[model samples]
Every structure is written in structure tokens, then in C-alpha cells.
Target: MDQPFRHIIALAALALPAFATNARAEEAALIDGGKLLLTNGVTTIEGASGGGLASWATIAGRGTDRGIGLSTHVTLIELPDYGWQSHGVALGLANRLELSYARQNFDTRDVGTALGLGKGYRLNQDVFGAKLRIAGDVVYGEPLLPQISVGVEYKRNRDAPVALTVGANAAKGADFTLSATKLFLSHSVLVNATARLTKANQAGLLGFGSNGNDNHSLQFEGSIAYQLSRRAVIGAEYRSKPDNLAIAKEDDWLDLFAAYALTRNLTLTAAYVDLGSIATFDKQRGGLLSAQLAF
Candidate 1:
């Protein structure tokens, strides 16, 4: 098995028993949860607490009233001519603050050979993020106010030479996001809107900006989810990308995803993603699979 997959399996094996023991010992004592099961959210691309493609205004744990929660996820995407794999860990404190770290590997695949870099070329990136939920409540259905949060992602690309060759101005950049998320329990629906300021191209895989325009631009990302059952959620997400480099124009990303909670601490998510064009490769649509372990 691949090293990353092995690591995930090992970690899950070790943690699952602890979680099961704790739950068994405390089953009768219910922790007054502020949000619904699987509602705290799946991990975002940048490792924040949110949907698959974009970050939401929620923290990363089921412990809503108080306590700490930790979540880790492994995501894999197989595009038409490329591939992407990401894994990350996030920790949420008191359902008010969140911190995360993620590693991304973009596989050039055959495209690498076409670009004269041989086959199987990969670009690596690391992302560190922090978020603070400032106001409102997602489950506060009585007043129907949206949850609001602010976040920042500091991204660094390891393929600096390749990024520069592709017209990227820098290998490092930061993105700031302000998100508003609202959930209607009566209607079993949730909606989120986010505005982001970023200079990173292709979510930092292609690096930050270009020579001509080295400043950040405002972008939008959103998600809408419907709760089908106590443990199932179906959602769709859209994320607009920055067009910074001239070598290969970036495009918007979209995904239709479903998440099912096997238990309070385990959730699985799958999605059909249409990433539009990436690096001049059209129709970079693919499937995504993600497993999240949370406590």
C-alpha cells in the first residue's frame, strides 16, 4: 500500500479504539451538542472546517457547548489527465477557534511528459490555516441568524522552479476568507457564502500571482447542503479561482458531494467534481473520495 494510505490506516486503528472506549464509558452522559451530527462539517481543501471545496463558518468538532475536537481527513481525486491527493489534520477548540495543516500533491501524470518533464511529475504544497468563529449560530433556528467566521491560509509550494517556469510570481502566498453559514433545521437545509482575498493561483498549486499582477483579488466560494437524514447530507459547492498566470489559465471548481456519518466520530464523503480547465487541460472532471475521523 502507499505510504500515506498506510499512515491513515494506522492512525485510525489507534484512535478508533480510544474513541469507542470513551463513548462506551460515557454513553449515558450526553454532551449537549450545539450542532447536529455531521453538521460541524467536513474538511475543506485548505484543511479548514467546511465543505469539500470551500470553508464554512463552523468549527471542526462535535463538541459544541464546550471541549476540544480533532479531525483528520484524506482526500484523493483522479482527474481526466491529472490527479491530486491531499491529507490534513484539524483541531477545534471550544467550537470557537480552529487550526489546521494540510499537504497536497498534484500529479502531472502524462502531462508531465508532454511538458518535457517526463512522466509522473508531481508538485507539492503545504497549507496552514487558522479560523475564528466570531458570531451567530448555525443551529439557532429560532432567530435564523447565520454563523460568521474569518480565516487565513498560508500556502507554500515546494515546486518553486516549476512554478516560476509557468509564469507564477511567487511560491508562497496567503488567502483570507470571510464566511457566513446558516442552517435551517426545520427545512433541513444549510447555505453558506464566502468572500476570499487571494493571490494564489490554482489553490496555490500553481503558486501565487504572476509578474504583471502580483496583488490579491477577491473571489467567491459557496456551498448548499441538504440533510437527508440524521446521518446523511448532500451538498454542492462552487469555488472561483484566480486567473493570475498567463501560461495556463485557471478556472472555477464545482462539486456535488454526499456525506454519511457511520458514527458520531466517523464520516465518509464522496463527490463528483468538475474542476473545469486546469493548466490548459479542458474538462478536468473527476471523482473525489474522502474519509474523515473526528472526535
Candidate 2:
């Protein structure tokens, strides 16, 4: 790992043990899985809670205001020229704070050989994230107030050499996001909007910004969903991303997704995604499937 990445991990390591000890001492008082179904939202690509392509203001897990909860998920994506898989774990505290970690692998497949990087080459990344709910509630409290949150994600690219060779300025960077979300009980609809500041290329799979474009840019993500039943929802999401690398012309991502709760603790999500172009290859559309377990 790079020096900065090592420092980030070490800091988390030092704080986690102490927090875990305290949490264990109050385990009985802390864990109460009482949130309503699907209100906590599904896991996003980077492991935060929301739609597959966008993050929402809702926290992770099915925890109530006075409880702690855990969630885990695995996601897979199949594209014409690439393959993607990611898995992660998240912790929600008092339905106000969330901490998450995810690992992503992007397989280049035949495109790797065409680019002279050998067939089946892969790019890997690790994302560490934290979010704090600042106000309101998604399904309760003031009807139009909405839930608001601020978050940050630090991403580390595992293939630093390749990233540098491709003109990326750094292999590690951070993204800051602000989100607002609301659920209208009368209409059975949920809406969310998020603003992000980032310079990552392909969400840091290929790396951060190119040498020529190292500045972070503002982006937007929006989602709208309708509740079909108590346990099922269909949604659509659109996410704009920064095109910071000169070698690859990146594009915005959009998806139409459906999620169903099989049980109080398990939910499955499926989506048809259009990722646009990636690394000079066009029409990189695909299907995404994910499974999440929460308590």
C-alpha cells in the first residue's frame, strides 16, 4: 500500500477497537432492528446505502434512532467488454451515522489484450466511507423536510503503476457528497438527489484525475422510485460523473432497478445499466444483480 493509504487504514484500525469495545458493553441497549422495510435503502456500488448507481441520504441497515445495525452485500455486473464485482460491509449507528468499506474488481478481459496489457487483466480498488445524517427522516417526521446527509469516500487504486502509466496523477483520492431524500407515504414514492465533488476516473478503478485534469468537479445523482407493495419497489437512477482522464472518455451512468425483500433480513436487487463508454470502448451496457443482508 502507498504511504497515505497505509495511514488511512491505520487510523481506522486504532479507532475501531475502542469503539467496538464500547459498543459491546452496551450491546443490549444498542441493537434494535426496528426500521421499516426498504426504508434503509439498498447498497450502492461503492457500498453506501441507496440505489445501485447513486447514494441517498438514508443511512445503512434497518436500525432505528436508538439502535445499531449491520449490513452486508455482494454485487455483480456483466458488460460487453468488462466484468465487475464488489462486496462490502456497513455499520449504522443510531440511524444517524454510517461507516462502510468495499472492494471492487474490474476485469478488462479481451480489451486487456487489445490494449497490450494481456488478457483478463483486472483493476482493483478499495473504498472507505463515512456518512452522518444531519437532519430530517426519510419516512417519518416532517412530510416535506426530507433526510439530509453529508458523506466522504476515500478510494485507493491497487494498480498504481498502471494508473500512472495511463496519465493519472494519483492512485488514491476522496469524494465528498451531500444528499437529500424523501419518501411520500401518500403517493408511495421516494425521491433523492445528491451532489458530489470528485476527480476520480471510473470511480477510481482506473485511478484519480489525469495529470492534465486534477481538479475535482461537481456532479449530480438523482433517483425516483415507486413502491409496488410493502416489500417491493421499482426505481430509476441517473448519475453524472467526471471525465478526468484524457485517455478514456467517461460518460454518465443510468439504471432502471427493482428491489424486493425476501425476508426482514434479506433483499435482492436487479438493474439494467447503461455505463456508456469505458476506456475507449463504447456501448458498455449490462445487467447488475446484488444481494444484501441486514439486521
Candidate 3:
């Protein structure tokens, strides 16, 4: 394990009991059979309950069947010329709301040397998020209404001077999102749509905005998943982004991913990611792996 990821795992291990406290009534049973498998989706890179690169309509918790679901995840992505890692914890309260916090580290790799920053300069960001499942259910909705959620993420970038030196406008920003998810159980397929408003560049990892333009833009994220079994899923996702920074035009992100429940409390995820370009690096294609523990 990497240093940052290991540190986060330690914290999560200590916090796990707190997140699972509400479920003591069921924990004693040791066999959580009532809660259907794979209902609590995998943790997104931003620490929200979602797909690999996009937020899903489903809440973080298991469902009404389970009390509280707390999850911790570590994601690492290796691009052709860039490296990124993020770790976070998400807590779901009664499957109705979610709270998440994440720390992201972006290794500039060769870009750092080109910019005279260092051989492998890193940009660190802290993100805090909250989400509310306002209506419907992803799996058990009646009359075909989709599950809906509203969310917000506040991002704080640590290296503002570097971003501004490179022609960025601001360093901190928040994104507001709305998501709707539906499950066609009979067909074994799931679909979701999400809308986000933001002015952040590179999802706030490259700062908030650039001097040329700083207006908040509406972005879209869509996902489709096919269930292969009770504990496994395959999905594809696309997330649009704003080209707010003049230093480097931003591009949309896409990924194909899989999530599997190894146990009621453990889930694993793997993905192939494509982030067109950043700063000056092009064809940023890579893979992502994440492990989640929830109860």
C-alpha cells in the first residue's frame, strides 16, 4: 500500500466501528442475509456513492433493510504521464443521506519538471461532500419512478499559487449535482443520469478556474450497469467537464468498470479510465483499482 492510502486505511479502520454502530442489532447475527447484495454501490473517486468516475443515484448505504452503511476506499490511477491517488470514507445514514470526505493527490510526473516545479510535483486537494436521497429507490421504486438525489461537494486545493502562476483564476470551488437512477430488475440492467454545476478545472484537482473564464457550467454524467449475478456488476460511465482553465483545456472523462462484493462488508472495483488531456499531457489513459469496506 502507498503511504497516503495506508494512512487513510488506518483512519478508516478506527472509524469503522462508529459507522457500524447503528447496525449492532444486525451485526450480532453475523450473517446479514436480509440486505440484498450489491445494493450499496461502489465508492467513487470523489468519495461519493457512485460509479468509477460519476456519481450514481443510489445512496451509499445498503438500503432500508440495513441501518447505516459506512465505506472506506482507496483509488489509484496511473496515466501515461500522470499519476493520481485518492482515499476517503463515506457514511450512509439509513440509506437516506450520505457524507463523504476525500483527499486527492495528483502527481505531475514529467509535467512538473517541464514547469520547473520538480520531477514529480504533487497537487493535493481535500473534498467534502453531502448527499440526500430525496425521492424514490434505485431498486424498489414503484410505478417506474427513478431514485433521485441532490448533492454538493466542496473542494479545497492546497497549491493555489502554483495554479495561479499557471493562469488559473481561483483555487476553491463547490459543485452541485442532481442524480436519478433506475433499476430494471427483470432485465438485469441499471441506468443513471446526473447533472452538475461547477467552475472547477479537472474536478478541482487542477484548481477552481482560470483567468480567461470562470463561469460555472452545467455538466452531464451518465451510467449504465449490467448485473451478472447477485454480487457482481459491470458498468460504463461518462462524465462531462468544463474547460475553465486557460492553461490547459479540460476534457470529459469516461470509464468501464466492474464492482464485486467479496462479502457483505467488502467490495472490490477495477476500471479503465480515459481523461483526454491535462495541462499539456494528452491521451491520459490508465487503469483504476478501488477497495471498499462497508457495514
The best candidate in terms of TM-score: 2
Alpha carbon lDDT of each predicted model: 0.84, 0.89, 0.81
Q: Which candidate is the best by lDDT?
A: 2
- What TM-score number comes out for model 2? 0.91
Candidate 3 local Cα displacement, residue 224, angstroms: 0.4
Instruction: For candidate 1, write residues 198-226 as lDDT tens digits.
Output: 99988999889999999999999999999
Off by over 4 Å in 3: 1-34, 63-66
- How accurate locally is residue 41 in candidate 3, as Cα lDDT from 0 to 100? 76
Q: Which clashing pairs does model 2 show?
A: none
Lowest lDDT 10-mer window, candidate 3? Answer: 2-11
Give the RMSD in angstroms, all C-alphas superposed, for model 1. Answer: 7.8
lDDT of 2 by residue, 9-75 (tens): 5545544554566566666666678998999999998999989989999889997766687999999
Sorted by TM-score (best first), the order is: 2, 1, 3
**Across residues 1-295, which tens digit of lDDT does each residue of candidate 3 receive?**
4333343344345435544664674654332333467766788888898888999876675545346666788999989988999999987765666779999999988889997889999999998887777788888859489899888787888999887887778778778889998888898898999999988888887787677778888999999999999889999999999987666867899999999999887889999999998887789999999998876
Better of 2 and 3 by TM-score: 2
Model 2 alpha-carbon miss at residue 14, Å: 18
Q: How many backbone clashes does candidate 2 have?
A: 0
RMSD of each: 7.8, 3.5, 6.5
